[model samples]
Target: MQYNYNISRITLNDDSHQLIGEILFPTINNDIVLLEHVFINPTFEQQGFGSLLVAEFVKHAIHQKLTVKLLDPFAKLEFAKHPEYQQLLINE
Candidate 1:
């Protein structure tokens, strides 16, 4: 089955709007937004940019009163193993 969604490219402020990350949202249902893919240049990693992007998207979700869903490959198993992520999964 094909799901309907929208993809938005996040850009930088410099001369060129270099692609930083992307935000995906279901077109049929706006109540939930998926954080599909988020990646920063290796050189730029660990500088809070990923968090900044997520924070901005979360802010948007808050303003829109929408639920945010994220799929983390690494965190999946770890989440299942941990209490915090397990709680988060249950909440979701």
Candidate 2:
């Protein structure tokens, strides 16, 4: 089975200003941002594009004083394996 939902995409570019990768997120409530899909094109995968996308999202969230909830597969794993992530989950 598959589930579909709307995502707002944000893209970043290179020095030449060419688009490289995109991050997709869903807005929840009026004060939360739920990151749903994050992809760094195969060609840009290991170059921190994913982190950059996350950082951008964080910046927006901070500006709006919104809580950020990343509901991706790795978020669960990180929650399970990292104390910091677990604390974040608990704090929210």
Candidate 3:
């Protein structure tokens, strides 16, 4: 089997495409965009793809002027190590 992976923004009603991974942010009244979940297909984990996906999401959040609120800090710590992500860190 072969797998191709990419990052995409998906809503609850939209499921036409197969998702290798996803980061979900629930709608709420706040300046912070909560990263509710981050998932990668097992076949794709630990190969740097997760970080790339996170970086993409971070870019999206920053563009919307929302701070990223990571619910699972440990899941994101790997991606946060990249220097470009320093500004997005929320003090815990």
Ranking by lDDT: 3, 2, 1
lDDT values, one for every candidate: 0.45, 0.58, 0.58
TM-score for all models, in order of appearance: 0.53, 0.64, 0.63
- As a TM-score, model 3 comes out at 0.63
lDDT of candidate 3 over 21-79, digit per residue (tens) = 66676644465556777777675667665666676677776777666666756446855
RMSD of 3: 5.9
**How many clashes show up in model 3?**
0
Candidate 3 ranges beyond 4 A from true positions: 1-17, 89-92
Q: Taking the tens digit of each residue's C-alpha lDDT, what string does model 1 give over 24-48?
A: 4342254654545565556556665
User: Would you list the clashing residue pairs of candidate 1?
Assistant: none
Residue 20 of candidate 2: its Cα lDDT?
A: 70
Name the lDDT value of residue 46 in candidate 2.
77
Q: How many residue pairs clash (N, CA or C atoms closer than 3 angstroms) in each of the candidate models, in the order given?
A: 0, 0, 0
Deviation (Å) of 6 in candidate 1: 7.9
Q: Which of the predicted structures, 1 or 2, would earn the higher TM-score when compared with the native? A: 2
